[model samples]
Target: MSADPTLQVSVLLPVYNAGRYLPEALESILAQENICFECVAVDDGSTDDTADILNDFARRDARLRVLSRPNTGIVGALNDGLALCRAPYIARMDADDIARPARLARQAAYLDTHADCVGVGSWVDYLDPEGEHIWTWKMSANPAQIEHDLLEGGIGGLVHPAMMLRADAIRAVGGYQAECKDIEDYDLFLRLLEQGHFSVLPEPLLGYRQHPASINATSNRGARTAIANRLMAEARQQRGLPEKVLTPTPATPESSQLEWIDLALLDGNWRSARKTTCRLFRSVPLKTAPWQALGKLIQAALGKLRIRAGRIRQFVSIF
Candidate 1:
């Protein structure tokens, strides 16, 4: 370990209604190894006992610092924390998630080795409140791969709770944007990509908690998708891409696959549906590997085309 004080890192965690799991989350950070860091916990006017929990923890540990303020939502809270951060590097941790013991150490090591890499995350194992492992999402090990994947989806592809980056780099990109507040991490990653590469550790170093009240679980997916589509449009404009490319086309050759899969299944075209389903199964691996594959196979077997034309006509006539 380098005995350099300038390498100190600041861990910023913005708290909302996170009373249920805040203690465990805080404990995870306190247990981190091989890193000299400060923990900044900002309470975003949580109506729950979140503030009380933060106070109790702050009293116990000198390393843990707490900021209590009115709720301005996550984006505001994060930006506030960002402005207050004094360390050279900043890491993000959600109040409801658990960071593996090596989370900080690993991220700090990577940033130290590759000074050009602005940000780094790691593969994560999703867990429920009781700490049961539900699924895993792998992330990009190379920053270039992350950027390419972002064009298709979001770079830092599947972001985890344990993310570390250069504070200055984030500031340079104008911090986080409110327009993309809901998808702030993705937006920040895009901006960071312009400055330097962002990569993730191959091994799972973060245990992300998935609860009913979590942002991803509670937010409307349709609305988020719409917002993401808009961001893509704006991003194209920023990059000077053609107007045609800037506008989201009506399902490209890539999306056509999904359309065909739906049509095949509805038309009871088992062969076609099976082939398309197989293509999807091969392309994307689900978290529940066995269950998802089995369900897809069953759907392929019972393709909608299996229904007789006469029965369909009779049902339609009755309606």
Candidate 2:
């Protein structure tokens, strides 16, 4: 816990098996200008080279401190980092995401000016695995708009990793609750909003990468709906707030499996493609997964044939 007395912010980055994109994430933070900060990166027992990567960065940058521990999961890693975050303001960063160079400096300035704002987050640019911009999560700028968005539509109204918050306020709310699980950020926001205002900066301060095995892919739609209902119920009963959970039609198991298969194809992971194909074959009532799997299988076979034919042609030419 090498915290600076003059540090205005401490960035809590909890890393798991994120060796692929860890360097880029850290470099982005190191690029920040005129920001007095410390990046408290807790390496939560990554099986990959994540520990080595974090240690290398920590050795180079005095502001970055790496804590290596056994795999206690995300909740444990977050709580550990939060406990050691010794700064007036605290920020969150993800191992697989890149923080904009100006992100830390701007958020720190905002908290300094806005005495009533307990936490502030910026809008995020969503990127595909190839790092191409897909879309943006444009969060509301003011507390009133954010609260309205949360209640009326059951949105947390804030991007989790792109936030800067008051350390004292977050500690007062008891850090992040483990029960929240997949929706921990929303739970934290609900608790913090009870204390003071939570708002978003208009700037795009983070680039979040999407992968097939990501949280967005693995999240249970049913669980999310339950959380939304719970939030709406609490709001109505306690604050007399009018809130509606606009539920989307749930994806069938077959369709969801097919979606994963397609994603696997796009990612060029044939093993995953074949694994998903087997599950789809076993699914009752039959569905699009079977048909999609057949097409993909044929395409792969044809691709292999093409390569073999090309190789034979070259060998014949040499003879």
**Candidate number with greatest lDDT:** 2
Off by over 4 Å in 2: 1-4, 242-319
Candidate 1's C-alpha runs over 4 A off are: 1-7, 158-160, 237-319
lDDT of 2 by residue, 1-319 (tens): 4545799989999999998989999999888888888889999989999999999998899989888899887878899998888888999999889899899999999988999999999988766555655456676787888876666645545888898999989889898887767777777777787778887888789997766557766678678668767866676557776655657546555655566556656655666667667656776435566877778778977987999999999999998
229-309: candidate 1 lDDT, tens digit per residue: 676666667777643322323423224444444544454455554554455556555634334444755766555446566
TM-score of each: 0.73, 0.76
Cα distance off (Å), candidate 1, residue 159: 1.0
Q: Indicate the residue-level lDDT of 131 in model 1.
A: 63
Q: Residue 251 lDDT in model 1?
A: 29
| Candidate no. 1 TM-score | 0.73
Which model scores highest in TM-score?
2
- The superposed Cα distance between candidate 1 and the true structure at residue 317, in angstroms, equals 54
- Among residues 3 or more apart in sequence or in different chains, the pairs in candidate 2 whose N, CA or C atoms overlap within 3 Å are none
RMSD in angstroms, all models? Answer: 11.7, 10.2
